[model samples]
Target: MNYSIGDFSAITGISIYTLRYYEKESLIIPARKENGRRSYAESDIAWIQFIKRLKDTGMPIREIQKYAKLRAQGVTTMADRMEMLARHRAVLKEEIGKLEEHLSNLDDKITYYRTEIRKCTNLREDRRTAEVSCCT
Candidate 1:
């Protein structure tokens, strides 16, 4: 069943304005009713979700528009789509590597701080014990 733009936006968690922007950008083209109202389908839901994923993964709008154009061309563009996705995947992998390195650095710093805190605590306790023994 086709859904009105409001319903589609609710279902997709995309704002109505952004949906209109997507249509304007040619990233998506919802069907227009006789009244010129935008209508979306189940297929549009899946397409929009995929589009969101691409956006989340740092794919530029221009690149997404290119992919959308290729998709509109049908099965003949599968190889082209695959190539685009492969390139995106490589970029994501590189980003993941850098993030992992940053996380490791954070972990090392946290470990160092913990060790230093423990040493300070031990030194304070030892000092207190020595002072008590010498005064007794």
Candidate 2:
């Protein structure tokens, strides 16, 4: 189905300005009508969703534009596209490893807090006040 630019923006969750910007950057090339109005098709929706995913993955605009250019070149650039995606995947894996390490550290801190809380409760039962090493 053909949709006007406004309709395209609404469906894609991108602002009209951003849609135009993408067009200007050659990241997206929407179909134009006789009156010089931009229109989008179902394929454009799929393309935009893929573009959004790539952007979400921290792909730079220039890289995305490069990918888009390759994509527009047809099946011959499949290898190059695969290479780019593989690079991004490696970066994502490293990021995930860092996140996991941070999460583990947080879990360790939580466990320490639980133990400290129990000790404080026990000390409070024995006396009016408990000295926490953290405060000293």
Candidate 3:
């Protein structure tokens, strides 16, 4: 079924302006009515959802647009699409490595603070014991 721009916007959670912008950016191409109204298909809705996911993953508009273009061109571009996915995977790997390094640093800091706290608590306990003996 074909959906009007408003229906597309409501169902896809993309604003009408953004839907237009996506068309302008070549990220999406909805069918146009004779009067120039945009008619989106269910497939277009799915594509928009995928685009949103790619954006959330930090894919740039240009790259996403390119991917969308390649996708629309069909299975002949499979190798190129694979290359794109490989590039994205590399970026994700680097990001994961950075996060792991940050986590390690945080863990070390936590260990250091915990050790200091234990020492301080032990010292306080020693002081309390000495005072009790002296009072006796």
Candidate 4:
């Protein structure tokens, strides 16, 4: 069944403006009525969801567009698309490694702060005990 643009937006959780923008950017191409009302199909829905994933991956619009173009070219482009995905995967791996390094540093800093707190607490307790004994 064909879906109106509003229905498409509701189902996909992509705003109507975004749907229009995708169409304009050639990332999506929904059908149209004779009167020019936009209509979407199940394939369009899947494409929209895929586009969301691409955006979530921090893919640039130009790269996404290139991927879209390759996709439109059919099975012959599979190897090229796979290569593109592999490149993106490498970048993501490097980013993850950097983030993990930062996380390790944060963990070490947290441990240092905990040790300092413990030392300060012990010193404060010792000073309190001395003052009590002297006053007595």
Q: In order, how many clashes per candidate?
A: 0, 0, 0, 0
* lDDT string, candidate 3, 17-133, tens digits: 998898999998888899998899988878899899889888999999889989989999999998998999899899999999999999999998888777766766878653332
Task: Give the Cα error of residue 117 in candidate 4, in Å.
Answer: 1.6
Q: Residue-wise lDDT of candidate 2 within 60-136, one digit each (tens)?
A: 99999999999999999999999999998999999999999999999999998899888777777677665645432
For residues 1-136, write the lDDT of model 1, one tens digit per residue: 9999999999999999999999999999999999999999999999999999999999999999999999999999999999999999999999999999999999999998888777766876878653332222
Q: Ranking by TM-score, best first?
A: 1, 2, 4, 3
Off by over 4 Å in 2: 128-136
lDDT for model 3 comes to 0.88
Candidates, ranked, lDDT: 1, 2, 4, 3
Candidate 1's TM-score: 0.92
What is the RMSD, in Å, between candidate 1 and the native fold over all Cα?
4.8
Q: Which of candidates 3 and 4 is the stronger one according to TM-score?
A: 4
How well is each residue in 21-136 modelled by candidate 4, as lDDT tens digits?
A: 99999998888999999989988888889889988988888988999999999999999989988898898899899999999999999998888777766766878653332222
**Between the candidate structures 2 and 3, which one is better when assessed by TM-score?**
2
Whole-model Cα lDDT per candidate? 0.93, 0.90, 0.88, 0.88
10 residues in a row with least lDDT, candidate 2 = 127-136
lDDT of 1: 0.93
Name model 3 segments beyond 4 Å from true: 115-136
| Shift of residue 8 alpha carbon in model 2, Å | 1.4
Q: What clash pairs does model 3 have?
A: none
